[model samples]
Target: MLLFQLAFKYTKSQLQRPSYWLAVLSFALAISLMVVSLLVISAYEKTFEKSITQLLGQIQISYLSPNISLPKVLSYLQKEKIKVAKVTSFIHQEALLVKNGKVKGVLLEGLPAFEKKASSFFLKKTLNNTAITNFSKDRYGAYVPVLLMKDMSLQLGDAFSAVVAKSMGKNDFNRKVLKFYVKGVLDFGRSDYNRRYLLTSFEALQKPLKLSKKKTSGARLWLADKVFSEELSFKIQKHFSSKLIAQHWRQWANNLLEATKSQKKMIFLVLLIILIIAAFNIMSALFILIVQKTKELSILRVAGLSVTSIYAIFSLQAVFTGLLSLTLGFALGYLWAYLFLLIQSRYFSVLSQIYKLNHLKIGLPLWDMLIIIAVVLFLVLLTAIIPVYRAGKNSLPEGLSHEL
Candidate 1:
């Protein structure tokens, strides 16, 4: 307790020193910089995940055949007690969208009118402005991406036509033009998805494509826990008897996921190098403090204080400094994150095309962040020990004879 008191006094005394404050500020800035970078990267990764999952679900069951029995697949999943959160069926076909004589090729997605999960792809902020209605209300209504709307010069309630293919024979193909009204506009973040994707009702597309009411291209399954996607996909394929194949989104989006991870590792390496330099700066400050107090330490030694007690006092002082710096750093980092999020919310739409995110959100698991902070603190203590140990080794005569 006495040694801790002495350590506290020495730590407080150093607060008035410019060199000590410089060390603290440097370490704090490094911490805040790392926190901000990590938060932004984490946000980007989550946005990518949401965009992919919104389009593909966690797992997709597809067949090359014109259609599959959606009820049978749903029953099979129920019979197997699969951990499915939501299942949405869709029909995917290539079609040509035409407006005012301008034609563009697009991927048409036919979603069931009852699947409210399909609304996930819509940018909610624009829903009020555009008056997005349910497909159930308007069977002939279509949802077009924002980019497609711009390219085709389309507006809500505008009439358009989709030229779909209907094969009349093995070698001959026929074209069927289906008219639709623009019901809503969507923003899926990625320019590719935004440019070429369109949505309509399953029945509206099924009849036009010469498919029966019981037919669909595929079903998307949202799992209770996505970590089990690969395992569930295998089980689904095994149960389907080759008529349908299940694929997890990770299969197609692996490159994006791997890139996010690699970028995170690169950022961490750069921040670690910065942290090491800051730690060395703090070490130098503490070393200088020990040198300046040599005579004071020698007087304490003469009064019967042991070298071990001297070492403990200095270690305590370092612990206090490290803890204080970390606290200030965390406060500054979170404050900045909050301010950035608040300010960026207003302009997210302008940035969404480039960043592929409709909104910016910051999330880092608290336990993981704590573990990182602990590792940093451990490194600081390890570095602090070197100077503390050297100070403890100073002989009584060497410390006493030093010029005051």
Candidate 2:
């Protein structure tokens, strides 16, 4: 109890030093910036993943070998009924779309006209078109991305021909021309996907490609929730054994994930450097406090206070400073994040120009918050240790006799 009283008194005295306030402000600023940057990166990664998963199903199942028998694939799918949610087959092929004597390479995707699980954002966008009411009946009508339509100089109701390549018995290429009407145009917010992709009902490509009703390039596996994608993918692979290749959305966008991860790592490294610099400021502040309190510490020692008690006093002072800074920093950081979100949403276009993002996004993961608190506490303790040790070692007469 006596030691605790001395510790409290020392802590109060340390607060009077100008160096203490400077250290607190510096540490707070560094932490706020680091937290905001982390939140922004995390939110962007999540949004990008959601966009990709909406366009492509959570998991995709394809033939492992080059041309597996259709019956074998169906048999494996039947066996995995419990794990599968909704299985929709699709045909993906590259074709040259020609208009006005100009040709552009396009990825043609053939899916069912009426998708039962049409709640996805991409599906909603596709269905918003007013041109074609019944996609099933309009076998010749097709949907093209807005960028592709512009590149091909295609207008509503305009007709375009697609030349599809076919593989014969030998290593040969055969060409088949199919006419298609422009029914709708879409924009997926990605320039590359929008510029080279075309969407059509299953019946449109089946006849031209000479594929049976049961055969498709691949099958998309939609789970009840996006969270089950990884588990479902593993189940699918085990059920299919060697007959099929199972991949989740993460695998489909491997490059994007890798890039995001690398960028996050770099940001973390930069933040760590900032934190170290802040910690150095804390060390300097504590050292200054030690010099200022040398005489007081010596007086406390002369009044029957132990060296350990003196050490604890300075350590408690440092901890209190860190905690106070942490509290203020978190509040300011979150306020900044909320305000930025509001501003971006209100003036999205202008903000997009400034940040290269459609809007401000911030995601504060609980783990990251805990990590920040732990790091701050650790740094505070580390910076306090040396100064506390020096204060504890001061001779009673020598320290008290020194002039400020």
Candidate 3:
């Protein structure tokens, strides 16, 4: 109880030092930097995760292998208790999109949603097209990406040609040139998709590619949620033959997912280093305080205070200092983060458009953040031990006769 009195008195007397205010400001900035970093990185990761989900379904079934008989797949899908929400087949093909002296290769996706005559019209309008409707009836219609429009100088109602073939060898005699009507443009926010993709309904690609009405390249399976898909994906792999490949988005967007995780971890490490440097600043402040109070501590020792009590006084001072710094830092960090988010969300919408960023979330999973903050606070408080030892180890006569 007496130790608390000395700690409070000492801290109050030391508040006149400019170094104390500097320490508070430094620690506040460091903590705020960490908080903002966590929020931005988390939001960035979530955007990419959503992009992955849209591009690749929860699970995919590929029928490329010849041994993958259709009967086994149908039977497996018919089993009860499977949490299958929807399964849609798609026609994925690599085709050459040739326009006025500019040619680019793109993945042409044929989806069932584009089955009707009015589907292309909606695709055009949604892809930032000024034109209202598509030109073709049952003929080939292609919705190119925005990247293609800029590079190829394409326009709605324009005519273009697509070469759909396995090989580039013109002498092989299997290549087919299918002319198409420019229906619209697409922008899914991912640069890869916006630059190298074209959309067509299954009907549009059927006559051009010579495929059966119901046949498709592969099927996309969506489960109720991501949690159920993992176990379901494993079950799909175990129950299905090796000839057929059953996969989830992790397998489909493996490179993207790996990159996002790595970037997040790297950002976290950088934050940790900065926070540690702040702790070091606090350590220096404590050492200076103990040195400045050395004579006062000697007087206390002369007045019947034990060495243990002296040490406890400094320890209590450190705890109080850390608590005060934390309070100030939390307030500063949240205010700064709020202002930053406001500026970013309002002024940098172009970046959001390019990157497909949704609302920025600030330090979600509040309990986990609380745990990390607690651990960091504990570590900072430990820095007091060094100064406490140095100030309390000397005898009463030695402390009283200090030169300074």
Summed backbone clashes in each candidate are 0, 0, 0
Winning model by TM-score:
1
Model 3, residue pairs in steric clash: none
| C-alpha lDDT (0 to 100) for residue 382 of candidate 2 | 90
TM-score of 2: 0.69
lDDT of 3 by residue, 1-404 (tens): 78899899878876788898788678767776766666666656665666556655778777766556445665676674666666677788888888877778888888787635334222445322344254454446667767677777887667888878854356663667777777666655565666767777887778766778767777777766568776777787787657667787777557755877797678777877887778777778888888777777889888888989988888888777777776776677667777887887677765456444434556535753685478567757777778789888866677677665
Question: lDDT for model 2, on a 0 to 1 scale?
Answer: 0.74
TM-score pick, better of 1 and 3: 1
Per-residue alpha-carbon lDDT of candidate 2 for residues 238-355, written as tens digits (9 for 90 to 100) = 8668878888988866776788789888987898788878888887887887888788777877888888877777777777878887887787777777887787668665534432
Q: Cα RMSD (Å) between model 1 and the true structure? A: 3.9
Task: Summarize candidate 1's per-residue lDDT along 274-318 as a digit string, tens digits.
Answer: 887888877887898899889899999999999999999988888
Q: Best candidate per lDDT, number?
A: 1
Q: Rank the candidate models, highest lDDT first.
A: 1, 2, 3
* Per-model RMSD to reference: 3.9, 5.7, 6.4
Give the TM-score ranking, best first. Answer: 1, 2, 3
